[model samples]
Target: MGRGAGAEGSWPKTARAALSGAGGRGDGGGWDVTVGGFWCTARPSGAPPLPERGWQLRVSAAPAAGEAVLSAVVRVLAADPCGFRFAAGQECLSVLDSGTDEPGSTGAFITVHPADDAQFQRLAAELDRATAGLPGPVLPADRPYRAGSRVHYRYGAFAPPAEPGDDGEHRPVPRRPGGERGEDARGRSYRTPGRGRLPFGASGAEAVTAAGATAGATAGPGTAAGSGAAAAAARRRRGGALPAGRYAVTAVVRQCAQGGVFLGREASGGAEVVVKQARAHPAAGRAGADARDALRHEAALLARLAGQGVAPRAVELIEQEDSVFLVQERIAGQPLDGWVAARLRRDDGPGVDWAEAGPVAHGLLDLVERVHAQRLVLRGLSPGNVMVRPDGTLRLVGLGLAVETGRPAGPAGTPGYRAPEHGPGRLAPARSRVADPAVDLYALGGLLFLLATGHDPLLPEDLPRARPVPERLGRWLALAARTGGTARRLAPVVLGLRAEQPRQRWGTARVRAALREDSPGRTDATRPGGNPGTASRSDAAGPSAVPPRPRLGGPRRRPAPAPPAVRRSPSDTTGVSGA
Candidate 1:
């Protein structure tokens, strides 16, 4: 059989190897499993209409009797299906966290039943035509085995070849990952001689997946393989707007440099949820590189922190052949900037008054304080990060770039919206250095300034005038805009830490009190308060917490559930009543 992929870095070479000699290769009682037919078409959620029977197969040669054990596991080398569906008797495994370089991998089996003669034949024909003469994925640790009996072939990156009887499907090991898995000279699956081995009669079968293979990444009774982005788009052209409902997709949410956001949604009601993923790992190959990845990070965090205001709630995580996608819950609301200045703006006369923006600015400031108190440093602390719901409620979003003092920080915050530690034009690398909290207070001030003045504090034109501001607002805004030497002096107090150096400028709570009395309506909601119905902060997810389990259970539960783990009550937080 020809190889499919290789390790020493090569592209079409591997793919071609697997598809070399499109049809007619293995004869079970047989020659090696030649590259018979390789049909790999991706449909990433919403662009075209898949032919009613566009999918086809044309592989020849029959396997021997006992060759029943010898099964071919169809894997998704790469896909971008927006709304994919797989047949029954398949396993869909969700691969979360598609890391910087190594995106997520997932897949199931080619449960092509014998009765499906037409579809199978079509699939075979298509595979032969497309993959003909293409090289196979190089199997570094090559092995030769006899027919009739199942032969486990190890290849470049491919492991756990196929299921023993029904033939199992397994994930291929990536070049590198946030973590590592056991491997041999070549990329093949091998169990530690005696570790976790299933008992003799009950052998623990091992199965992994190729990236982006299943619906919702779930493995169960009725599993399906999602198509790639291209195919899904074709389907959309054929069908109209989808009816309304959640859809399992293979597309990703994308943010552009121009700040334009585009997501692929199934035309009908909830047909498919599409998000544009960063093409090349480690970074995106498109515009809005920063915002794009930030959106991804934010989506993943929100997925992990579902229900919490950590980030917008995502519907599904779709790992396509080339990018990482997140299907997020579509929220209906305005950006916070719009709500803050809900009052009419009379741009006609310049000096008249922008006072209507008062409560808006104040509300924004109050929210900023709440954000900091949450013990998170939103690296992307700019106006664009905030959202204003149609109901006149303000929500701080885009936590994708936030720095949670508690968790192992990933690339969470954005540059401008980031804390003072981050530079203005460039974002800080995840490994650059450990970040501190004071920088957040500094950025909070900047964020507040933006709420007050539509421009950024860092911009020279947006700087406060040399003249003194009111004792109340001036003191607060001053601390927010303090830079260099001035920032060093007040930062420590603002951070509530005892340090006094530029790096260690902390702000203790006592010092905050000494600055000035609370600004008017500071405690009240950010919106108008006359209605008496202060919009309650959403019961969004909160900082991760570990509470003592209700002891009705004997010993503590094995293996903690995971963060955003608590049951959220009516309030935004879990267990504790919101003050």
Candidate 2:
């Protein structure tokens, strides 16, 4: 929490996957790749090869009862730096990392078209061959790596074991156990390969082999050397069951508004997982959010990370191809919100529940600290984004929006603590329209306020959910309101950070001081009742309202209003890709 921390550095020189984020990558030049279960990198005609732009390859298949994590690869091209794009799904699903998701980087996904499955097999074979001899990436279980660091496969260009080790073992990769580096798990845009300064100490090629980053993994034989259409077919049909590894997944778990979440398992093997089709809900996509796609992305991410987090690898995603299927590790425990809700239901005043719940809170905060120390920011932090199990161990799920640097960010916060800045471009407006550590804290504080107060801070009218703090918890709630729009006068610091003028937000140090504030040894309850007649929190006396975030995917016909510019680097680290 002090000056010992590393200074925030400049953006990566190339389009590397540094902590910046995933959307609107560096001067992408408007080129796009359609229909992906795989992404490939290529250079323009007669070029030296893309220096930073990277290509991705993953193989996934959903399951009957649970999903599997399979082998995936990230290939950086030295050829023309082209961009490949796709969407995770229409709606926002739960991301393990909460708010710190990389914007344009799609989660790992594998969707093999039935007709093309055959071709994918051969292509998979070739890739396996290529990667089999290549050096594996240098990353340990706990050691973090840059976003695009290549993980060698034993096929095609990514093959392994060009020279067998004297012991005949694919070199053993170093494992960091519980140590975390480079923005805690899923938060930062790590562009440096997992080679440098290790929290566990291993480094370089030794780190790669020491950690088993690419040892033992092999691709199949008899593959398509190359024939464009045939190659594409093979790539599309590579969707297969996820391979067993450090991670496991639930059969696609189904959550219905009517019946709650029902775990669907395979009828035969307990180890097998399954996914059920959506019941034609407007939100569910036909070809869009299909199960295969969901499982594909989940599996892809797991394989790419080698089962680093809670999301499981994909086994098989689509049955009907029209429905969306999601396969994941089937994490034990309830949603953090649900966990808190049950505790609150007991209604015992700050006694056993708090004592019992301490670990969960600590674990969540611990993760936040580690992530932020790595300079990773999960802008979107909410009870809904956290999970707590019976054992009290917590894993922050969701990484779709995590980013390394904070930019064009403001408050776009959840209800109660929804600061004035969260809307479109409220904070330093020049860069990306995303959240950072301060924003993450604002949300975390809001969640904490709810826990302490036993009321959802955001009333039905104030937010999307039913989280208003209980009257008894008013004093703590007031402290969390430091984000200007929501705080009471006693905790004026929160207001300073949340001040209408973006300039008032200042540096990360300034933001942190205001957000990490303490209660004044206790105070009066300002909790509102019916007709409490408080002015709407939105009536911030600083800057009026800024425009909302750009429409996620509306037609480009009309331009939206941009927010006021306090001015900072718009996440300068767009896809400064690194091959």
Candidate 3:
């Protein structure tokens, strides 16, 4: 029979009643059963309005009786719906099975494409009533199977083919996917087996599991299909955004070279969330795999760091067809740069005053120390990676790039904030270039310099003058330009932390001790109250200060090799709390 025009008035009364089982496919006395009366639509949550003359229903009968029922449904449902007057590939249906196959009995699965919500409700009511009369158990209508879960299908006895008519020809039946007629060696007509086999069991009946073929499959309900960047792109072309799964994009947060960052709202709950997407390079090969691997690594690290409270909580890692999405809890604060700008915008001009920024600097260090205590390294510690909370306290975010200490490091922090060891022409051999706690300390020192001088330490103009400040006992001339007691008090410790050689730099324990005045490591001499004109003979060559005898390439006192497992926390005296 030709497919209908989809208008209710044009639908034959007999066809409508047949759908309700007045003379259902079961009544036709065939093993292949046709279950109808399901109603769904192509509209995803928050999707734009479908095109005019949007959707239509099409029917696909099994090529022959006793075919795999699950395969038939998939091929039918996945078939081009546009041929029946629907908006081509734009339409999709959410199928729910109401069949009860107990022992020797079998039933059917219902596929629906309702025009609207009211229509869906009505169709669901009628389905429940119709299935109730059958001896099989009644499956609830609204309880559609979840995506990525399994389902079982059972085929009935096969019916014999219809006899040839007076024309001596049997009715034509469509071939299974990839099955075709070919000539045998004898030139006799023969059928070649298709590429795929029926994933069935030994018995006439077999369980057919639906691998992420449900309504929510778009958000990756199945086992990950190998970095689904291509699938994500297809969905974006169909709809303007990624497929609806758990979170729905609400607003664009920011756009970058990698991809776009968006603010999304959870579908189950209206809570606000942040969604960051990264699109793979269009070039298909090793490059695509590398991009996917990078994205996956970032998601995994952020997920692990989420518990440590220093980074944003990782809500979900969604791998779309052509992109990867990382959904995180919305952090209610601005970037460190924004906070600094706002502070300086107030009557205070140019540089960040030490009084206002010193505590913030301490808070950031304390947090980083906490992260290091967990045996993790904060590889990205630039101003862009830090945030100032509503309470004026500091919290670090973007742990996506952080890796375990001692692991071979990937790329380092943005330009000026990274340590010299992480910069070009490092003294350490490439094989021994593992990340260390010293890098974190070095970045913290650069941050201190920026907060004090309102300038990056590595800026080309300042590099010439800043190179000598690290070795000098006097206040850094750049920091001295701001001229505050707080600045002077902070200068010595900053220099100690920013030392070119990791071995000469102060450990977290030493820095904390200096801040608390509990250390005899020149803290007293470095304080503004102590003599500053000429450094104390002991101060200039102390272990925490400049080494008594400077060495080329590395420190005079080489640090012991790190442990094979977790490296010792930088703060050996007092342990910092974990995330």
Candidate 4:
């Protein structure tokens, strides 16, 4: 295919040559086009001469493959090439009769100015064919892409756009008559099951209210306030909002710039699930990959750790239009922070009782060991990402920020839980730092401190501060008074783990040893700083220490000769008292 400067702009020579059929099509084909980036943006109305031409494609390739696609499109339509304007990487494509071109600040793309409806249809069809096999869906040239089956919005908000002359009251979009179903890209049929349809354009809050009214009407008066909460979860076995109509969104758990996390239920089964939506090009970047790539990474990680009981199990990944959704098992627990706060509230004391906190601390330690054993660093290990079950077991959630050991660490993670080395902080530059297990260990220390005292180390008055500082006598004394020796006993361990320098932080082996020694079952001699002499006295006074006495008048048999003691190494503590 020959190339020329079309309406968009001068095409890149490299991109033109790459698509000139010089490289064959197929794996070995010389399809060596380097795509700098690809995205879509809204086009201004009126200038395009057609209302349907409201969006345009942005493609940045060294050889300018976008122009080649546009060229093919024009040839197929038998349209004039001047009607189109192309922008190579970071350049704007000028609009006809417009004062200025759309800014190319967000990257390069091709803009088409179709003169009529016939040209618009031809353009959309050709562009879709040209980019059909790309990573994401063929966008801009096609109609707006909806994420899930029933919901119109990509983030699973039930609000549909209000119809004209509706007086601003939110209303559900009417489904086609006959309860017709539609198929997704995967050719699976799906439809909304219930009579109540979601309002596609309503505000998120309104959409949430509609969903609650649909599902939470049966909840009692006591639960009326929390009816919209995720706790009122149930599964549907049929049609719903998600692809294949397999899951229906009940509540949106969290929403952020990246995307929203929804509490959904299985359409076929009654199990509750969590659906995490990832937009195509999230505002926030993750190691250069888009939110979709990050969600895929998280799904793979969850699959790898499945059945370990430390992380949520991956269910399935659904790709709809320009968004990706990850459906995972909904953990039946509360956030670690809330769990701690609830215990603190119930107790009359300033901090949680050590009896209640110790088990949680140990469970967290075990979880860390399991994750480290897999060579995965829980980069975002904050209390908010941890879930504590009623049975006292712990599970880690939100593994999107996790990275493999030795991978380049990015400026992602909770501020208070992040370590110094993984920084764009005073100690290190923001970039070029590699992931290390010590980062998680550092967070673990802060987490333990939170459990012990119900106060985050990030607080100004906490003993083990998130930032590095010289150990202050006053801070230690304050911690002792608050935790009543529970946190005091673990102060050295926490200090070692939270050391500003990664190398000075305690390793897994040392932490395990310290925790084992301080276990509740250990005797005085085995406890740290316990008096060794008191061990024999405690043992003699204990029920297990005294020998059994003859019960009857019958002559008591002489005590059997004691067995010979076997010498053992220091490491062999089996059957030995306080070895």
Q: Which candidate is the best by lDDT?
A: 4
lDDT of 2 at 157: 15
Ranked by TM-score, top first: 4, 3, 1, 2
Give the winner by TM-score: 4
How well does model 1 score by local distance difference test?
Answer: 0.31
Expressed as tens digits, the lDDT of each residue in 367-430 for candidate 4 is 9989988988888888777787768798888887778887887655666577766655545554
lDDT of 2: 0.32
What's the distance in Å from true for residue 121, model 4? 17
lDDT of candidate model 4 versus the reference: 0.48
User: Candidate 1 on 1-579: residue-level lDDT in tens?
Assistant: 111322112212333343243333321111121121221222222334432221111111111110111112222212101212221110011110111111111111121211133433343333334333321211111111111111112212222222234345454433323344433332121122233222112232221112111211211101112246533443343231111223433322222111112334454465333333332212221221332365566665565555544345566655433234445544445554343344223342211122433344345545645655665555455555555555445556545556565454433343333443344445655532554454454555444444433333332222455422112223333332222222222222222221112233223332343233333222111113322121222111111111112232345445322111111112111100100
Per residue, candidate 3 scores C-alpha lDDT tens digits across 39-69 of 2122122323332221111221111111222
How big is the positional error of residue 242 in model 1, measured in Å on the Cα after superposition?
Answer: 9.8
User: Which portions of model 2 show Cα errors greater than 4 Å?
Assistant: 1-269, 272-326, 345-347, 350-353, 373-376, 403-414, 417-419, 424-428, 431-435, 459-579
Pick by lDDT: 2 or 3, better one? 3
The local lDDT score (0 to 100) that residue 429 gets in candidate 3 is 53
Q: Given candidate 4, what's the lDDT at residue 15?
A: 39
Worst 10 residues of 1 by lDDT: 88-97
